[model samples]
Target: MKAPPFEYHRPSSLDEALGLLAELDEAKILAGGQSLLPLMSLRLGRPEHVVDIGDLGILDSLVVEPDGSVRVGALVTHRQVETSAEVAAHAPLLHAAAPMIGHRPIRTRGTVCGSIAHADPAAEMPAVALACNAAITAVSSRAAREIAAADFFEGYLQTVIEPDEIVTRVQFGPWPRHRRGAVVEQSRRSGDYAIIGLACWLDIEDNTITDAALSFFGVSDTPIRVAEAEDVLRGQAPTQSTFSAAGRTAAGVLRPTSDIHASANYRRHLAAVLTERGLAKATAESGETR
Candidate 1:
């Protein structure tokens, strides 16, 4: 298969990219070209113009902020992120989730922003972003603004970003000293897309859970975050009973669809099972037992 005929532009700067986006109709931004190029080659995405920002210096940063926030730019590849000491130290959950993405070759060229922009329900990055309460930075010729991760993803492959808007970076913060995080994903084979995945974190103090965050992907239209599950664990001792209860709560909120990989009921079951396993990892990492 071959991509449909389209004009290609490589912009030198963010402003130049924005101008091109604003002027071109049905133009698509090309980052690492991991996902987009495949869709294009399959004729699933036939844009009138292709704006490549891969050479833009402004969008290639990967820095750890003084305030404990990790800022990942749109042009930063997943391989770069996978080997980043700053990201590994400050955002271990993200680091763990990075390898779960496709394969080494795909990771070598897939940008983190591209994955987030794709907003696949089965993607690991979006779940990690939501769990971390990350802030997404988007820019356009008209304005620039930050959108909270919780609010950025609208549904499967959908976000609030306008056609002319480009996602610049995602910022996540306050990496706690006592942070215990884990990313769990189950797929048919290694590097395959997850059938169900979990990104979870817990902060423990004085032998009790001070805070907890749990997010699920591949089991719903969008990532699933059950506040009730977190509520059940907060201020409570980390125990199997509590984890079980939270898992059940999580399953109750899910409305997964049946697919060839797995049935809806099986997905629901995995949601509960994975939640327990994730909670166990969280508790153990936080210096507790269950």
Candidate 2:
């Protein structure tokens, strides 16, 4: 398949990109083009123009903040996140999920912002963002603003991005010291989209769970933060029984749809199993259990 004919613009700066986007209502920003190109090639997305941001220097580097948070540029590839020592030390959960995103070749070309912008319910980064409480920065010709991860994703393949806005950077807060985190997903085959996936972060203090965040994908219209499950784990002593209860609670909130890849019931089951496994691994990593 071939993409529909479209005008192409490679902007050298963020302002220029914003200008192009503002001027062309039907234009699409091209990051790594890993997702957009595929959709375009399939004729699923037919934009009047393609604005390439590859030449923007400011959107291509990872910066570690003095406050311990990490700012990932929009153009930063998944492979960079996977290998970044700064990301590994400060945001291990992101590092943990990076390798699971896709194969090495896909990761090499998939940009973090592109994945977030695509807002696939089955991708790992959105769940990681939700679990880590990351912030996304978006820019336009007029101004720039930050959006919380919880509010960034609106629905399936949908986001809060305005037509002319471009994601510039994503900032992730530092992972808690001694915190336990885990990511588990079930796909039909390696590198395929997940049928259900779970990412969890747990902080233990004085042998009790002080904080717990659980996020899920592929079981809902959007990446969901499992608040009920997190509530069940917080302030509780990590135990098999508690983890089991949390899993059930998490599974109860899922409203998965039957698709070619998996049935809703099967996805629900996977959600429960992955939630349990994630919770168990996170607890053990936190040293909450002897």
lDDT of every predicted structure (CA atoms): 0.88, 0.87
Write candidate 2's Cα lDDT for 93-193 as tens digits: 88888899889999999998789888998998888888887999999998899999999999989999999999998999866675888888898898888
Error of 1 at 78 (Å): 1.1
For every model shown, the clashing-pair count is 0, 0
**Model 1 over residues 1-290: C-alpha lDDT tens digits?**
89899999999989999999999899999999988999999999999999999889988999988887899999998899899877888878888789999999999999998999889899999999999989999999999999999998898799999999999999888678877888898899999999999999888778788899999999887877889889988988878888888889888878889999999989888988998999888667643211
| TM-scores of all candidate predictions against the true structure | 0.96, 0.96
| RMSD values, in order shown | 2.0, 2.0
> Model 2 compared with the native: what TM-score?
0.96
TM-score of model 1 (CA atoms):
0.96
What is the Cα-based lDDT of residue 193 in candidate 2?
Answer: 85
> Can you tell me which runs of candidate 2 are displaced by over 4 Å?
286-290
Ten-residue segment with the worst summed lDDT in candidate 2? Answer: 281-290
